[model samples]
Target: MAIQTIIVGTGRHIPAVIVPNSAFMHHQFHGPDHQPIDKPNEEILEQFEAITGIHERRYAPDDLLTSDMAFLAAEDALASSGIDRESLDGLIVAHNFGNVRPNAHRSDLVPSLAARVKARLGIRNPGAVAFDLVFGCPGWLQGVIQTDCMIRAGAARRVLVMGADTLSRVSDPHDRDSLIYADGAGAVILEGREGEPGEGILAHAARSDTFEHSTMLLMGPSYRDSAFLEAFFLKMEGRKLYRYALHHVAGAVKDCLDKAGVDLRTVAKVLIHQANLKMDEAILEALCRLAGLEGAPPGLMPMTISWLGNSSVATIPTMLDLILKGDLEGHAIRPGDTVVFASVGAGMNINAVVYRFPRS
Candidate 1:
């Protein structure tokens, strides 16, 4: 029997605090020298909203850590799947930074985050492995890809793939790049099931641009301000990132669909990484154009960035849970539908997975 990786359940954990764009109004902005550089707040916001389409986002309290968020999300996913944790075969965690504090730029690097979350879940199976995957923004999706291979290889029957990040802790609150991030976690339970046509992960494609790997996404050295210290803050070449996604990400999505022998019209939804709203819209337009789609259909590409901002690997899965569970008002998923998951970031890697929704 061919093993198919089917998503049995999904869950997410978002911080309690809701930060509107206005919250940054009076907050001090700083330059590389770490000195305060005050800009017209309203003008900054106008440009921000116009480009990113994000008005608000959630933030983990200074005390909250990446593993903490992952544990919360993992619990929800385990509960939703109704799967016994001890009986699980694998637990794979995806993340960039482990856990950081509000004033701390360095993430705790002692014990692996997967170990911490697995222990928190109280799973006791020597045979059930727990580990971490560091694959930049495509982290969680890469975890899923590995889980699929494991299931097919008979190394696991069930696996938990979770992506969590606390970019809020590492971000320089005053940086525009920091404005693009938030803290959150999303988890999916993948079970080895009988291969049912169009009812599991159908096809996928991945690519890495190694030449552009000069820390296009990077954290800087310690800052004079504790808030800015360490390699804590993230900086990026927005224009380059945008160009790569537009030129490559859409093509990757199209490739995955083609590999599945499906048409763009057959995909029920296109969930690309929630990096920027404007950039996402641009990618979708090019994607549709590549697929020969006429004016990309509405609601086919669900977005959570306007409210959630970007949580790195957590963005896609969290949005998937929100939409599938009907928590996301404008988007939806029905049984038997196929959804395309795609992302590009950090490692300059791009990947797309074609997933088929299952009917109960």
Candidate 2:
């Protein structure tokens, strides 16, 4: 029997602070008179807002850590699912960085997070499993695929999938790349749902081009030191990355759809990694041409990328939260609709999964 995993609930937590592009434009360039630059902050903000459809982004205060955001997002996901913590079978946290230095092992993190939730929510029966997957932007998609497999194999009944990152702390404020990255967390509750075939995770595919690994990477102990942070903070060959993402992601999506015996046209929505507005637009255009769609999936376009920039792994679920909140106007998804979740992260990794919304 194929395992049927349904997304029972989804939630996201973004920091209260709204950082606009103007914040960056003004801070970067100064006027000849040694005063503030005369660049039009409004124009910059408006161009970004129009391109990525992102008004503003959220960020944690100076003191808060990534785990804090993860905890909040998890609590909300569980609550929204209406399932008590006691009923959960396991927890999987997908992150690139840890709050504590040297980072605790996965075995240690599971119990720690579980204990935190138990003490806070008053549930103690469910066993907790925590592990860190440092796959950069593709981490969350990997978590979802892993959870689906566990549920299908009867290894777990319910799983918590979390994608949280605080890139700001490790980022170099002076770097253009660092300025684009923000911190956030998003989570989903995956549970068994009996349904017809092809209704859940129909297919998933991933491919990595390790040869391009050096294009984007963090050097040294992979730990943040002052000097390391200053030199190695979020460096990227933007042109190469943009090209690689389009090629690999497109291939991955087609492969997944082919494996599932579904055509691209059948896919109702494409929830791609919100890396960049221009890149996403290009990918969508290519996909539409290949699938022979009259145009992009009617309003099912990419979510906000300009404001949020590249949130690493948190992009998917963060966009999912927006979709749930009715923010994705004109492209409202419905039951039985087939959606594709695709992402390309550092390490030149690309992943794509096909799923069908259950008729509730």
Could you give candidate 2's per-residue lDDT for residues 1-360 as a string of tens digits?
Answer: 456888888888887777866566554432213244345656655655665555556667766666777788888898788987778887777777555222221123444543454455555664755556667789999999998888888788888888887776555444444445777888988898776776778888887788745456553211223333223345566667877877767767877888888888777788998877878888888777766776775666756665676678888988887786677555567788888899888777888889888877
Q: For residues 231-268, what per-residue lDDT tens digits would candidate 1 score against the true structure? A: 65777778778887888888888888999888888888
lDDT, candidate 2, residue 103?
Answer: 24
lDDT of each: 0.86, 0.72
lDDT of 2 at 172: 46
Worst 10 residues of 1 by lDDT: 221-230
Output the TM-score of candidate 1.
Answer: 0.95
Q: Mind sharing the TM-score for model 2? A: 0.84
RMSD of candidate 2 to true structure, Å: 5.1
